[model samples]
Target: MSQPQPDPEAPVLRAEGLYAAYDGTQVLCDVNLSVGVGAMLGIIGPNGSGKSTLLRCFAGTLKPTAGRVLLFDTDVATIPVRQRARLVAVVPQHTTTSFAFTVWDTVAMGRHAHLGLMQALTERDIRAVSSALEQTDCIHLADRLITELSGGELQRVIIARALAQEPQVLLLDEPTSHLDINHQLDIAALLGALNADRRLTVLWVTHDLNLASEFCERIVLLSNGHVAADGDPLEVITQRQLAAVYNTELTVMTNPLSGRPQVVITASKNEARR
Candidate 1:
């Protein structure tokens, strides 16, 4: 009888007891999370919740003051920069390059991990870059200058660049920040399609809990440097929890269309005193 084969794809990213800080001030505390292959995990929180910091830690850009981040069960610190880039790709909130590179050039740069230094672009790289641009619906803007594109166009280009990496895991920090509703839905649909077709593990940060609930299978809600809630969107995004974490009155209800948890913030009624 043939020996049983081990499951090759498992949890690709794990954060254990992660405590992070900047300039000696702690921003994240004892946060633990994991992303299995093909999973899309959404991170949501109010401002100052350290969601961006958490993404940085997972991307290996920021070292945790405490705890560890593991990639494929290996310490991320042990992974070389190039190898890590191949395994994980990031679409940061602000993607501003000093030089004025064309969109094609920027997108093709994602293939750097697969190419040796001083090597020419392979046919595979060209195909991947083209596919990425098409997936992000930015193929028409391919020849446009990076600085000439609008916010949404530029964001899609950056996302295409990350997709060109052909990474097993993808990370996006506030991907919908400057996008319109149409582009936001477009990107969300693209992410789902990519995960289903390519088995990409995604960890995305969002301030909009409704979008998080609609797009992700699981969510991690952070508040003041700690995970206040971690579970299904319906269970975790209750009115009480939202009030406590965000310091605002919110109505939590099932979305009529998607049947997912929908959060609506209500402005405070208390009047200011002289």
Candidate 2:
């Protein structure tokens, strides 16, 4: 049977009254959100605020106990795993492999979704992998072992693997969490470019408020398993909202270069006197 054609007019992804629990402990409650086609949305919140959990639900790796996730107006749970992999790709916070796999081989794994059982990589699959590597600037490292790459290089390789899937939507959980400032900026810029050039629907969970503010077209702030704020960076990433959710003393200021909100941590009076 032919797969259901996506409704172009519908939101690319939507969660309705989502509820999830892990080990019988509720993590998400009544979460509702919609991601439009080609949108770049960032999910931000304090640790344990269900940011990753929500992302897992959307990725179909974790089934919600209640409610549903819709991809192009069709239920995500009903889609076959391979079909879903073709439409959405996920980049987790960390990737590990004990065996020595070349960067090219690791990236080529993404083509499994498109291949039949025991099938070899076709010309199209090879092209996709090569394109992904090139797009992520990882082509130079194709012959290197994934275990030998730096954190930044490894992260880019992981993203390249995802891009090899040719997914319409990308779901990432803290893609830059382990990188240094420079690498973080590099990854962010790469994602921004992909979003603009390919119109890829990007939804990522991040703790870096400033990164989210600077890069995301929209931000959703989760607090206590609920959406505390959802809007453009300026509107959702305010000092008031962050202070309340983060329970910390911080200031939100406009970046001189980007005009986006930049979060600044403020020292307490006791610390200031030291």
Largest lDDT belongs to which candidate? Answer: 2
Q: Give the per-residue lDDT of model 1 (tens digit) for 1-274.
A: 0212223366788899999999999999999887777777789999989999999999999999999999999989889999999989999999886678999999999999999999999999999999999988899998888989888788889989999999989999999977888878877788878876787888989887878889887789999999999877777889899889988766898898987889875455323321
C-alpha lDDT of all candidate models, in order: 0.87, 0.91
56: Cα error in model 2, Å: 0.5
lDDT of 2 at 113: 95
TM-score of 2: 0.95
Reference-based TM-score of each model: 0.92, 0.95
Give the per-residue lDDT of model 2 (tens digit) for 1-274: 0212234477999999999999999999999998888888899999999999999999988999999999978889999999999999999987986779999999999998999999999999999999999999999999999989999999999999999999999999999999999999999999989998998999989999999999988899999889999988989979888989988768889999978899987567227446
Q: C-alpha displacement of 207 in model 2, angstroms?
A: 0.9
TM value for model 1: 0.92
